[model samples]
Structure formats: C-alpha cells, structure tokens
Target: MALIITDECINCDVCEPECPNSAITQGEEIYEIAPDRCTECVGHYDEPQCVAVCPVDCIPKDPDHVEDEEQLMVKYDKLQAE
Candidate 1:
C-alpha cells in the first residue's frame, strides 16, 4: 500500500528528501504522498524511507490504496522507468 502522511505531520521537512520516488510533497497543511509514485520503497529499500524518518510517526499505509507486495513491486518498477 502507498503510505500516507496524516494531519499529525509536524512539517519537519524530513520525509520529502527521504522519498526515493519523489512522491512526497508539501501540501497546504501537511506533506502528501502521491499514490501513483509511492512504492513503499520496494525497489530502493527494505522499508519506506519516509516512515523511517518521520518523527511524528504519522506516516501510515493508505487504507484507501491497499496493495500487496507484488503490486508494490510493479509500481516500483514503473517508477524506476520514469
């Protein structure tokens, strides 16, 4: 599943640089993760980089964009091609 930055985000400006896919961006109120570009770091790391660095622990799987490992890998591959 794509990870989401909840409202609890403190805007620490940490998660943006950690995203290999460059999916995370500053939103109006908090940072946002683009689902199409989010692979949960499948191709680049063992775990989601954003989640690892977020101090608030607000990054969570997008319940609305659930996906299995294989699906995440496909998304990761697609992102790599771009």
Candidate 2:
C-alpha cells in the first residue's frame, strides 16, 4: 500500500530524499505522500526508507489506498518502466 504522512509530522525534511520513487513532498503545513507513486519500497528495499529514518514515526500505510504486497510490486514495476 501507499504510505501517508499524518498530521503528527514534524516537517523534519528527513523523508523527502529517502523516497526512491520520489513520492514524498512538502505540503503547506506538513509532508505529503503521493499515493500513485508510493510502493512502500517494494522494488527498492525491504522496508520503506522514510519510515526507517523518520524521527517522529508519523509515516504509516494509507488505509484509503489499501494494497497487498503483490499490488505494491505491480506498482513498483510500473514505476520502474516509467
């Protein structure tokens, strides 16, 4: 599934560069994750880099964009093709 940055985010800027897919960006008040581009690092790493490095632990799977591991892989493959 894609990941989402909750309101708890501290705008620490640690996550944006960590996204292999470039799915994270800075919003007006906090960081945001692009659901279409997010694959939870399925094609890049075993774990999501942002989550691994986040100081506030505010990154979490997007329940609204729910997807299984296979789905995440598919998204990753599509991203690679692009």
Best by lDDT: 2
Query: What is the per-residue lDDT of model 2 for residues 1-82, given as tens digits with 9 covering 90 to 100?
Result: 7999999999999999999999998999999999999999998899999999999999988899999999999999999999
| Candidate no. 2 TM-score | 0.97
Ten contiguous residues with the weakest lDDT in model 2:
55-64
Cα error, residue 43 of model 1, in Å, equals 0.8
lDDT of 2 at 71: 94
Model 1 lDDT-worst window of ten: 73-82
Instruction: Note each model's CA RMSD in angstroms.
Output: 0.6, 0.6
lDDT of 1 by residue, 8-77 (tens): 9999999999999999999999999999999999989999999999898999999999999999999988
Q: How do the predictions measure up, each by TM-score?
A: 0.97, 0.97
Candidate 1: residue pairs that collide: none
Quantify how close model 1 is to the true structure by its C-alpha RMSD in Å.
0.6
Q: RMSD of candidate 2 to the true fold?
A: 0.6
lDDT of 1 at 11: 97
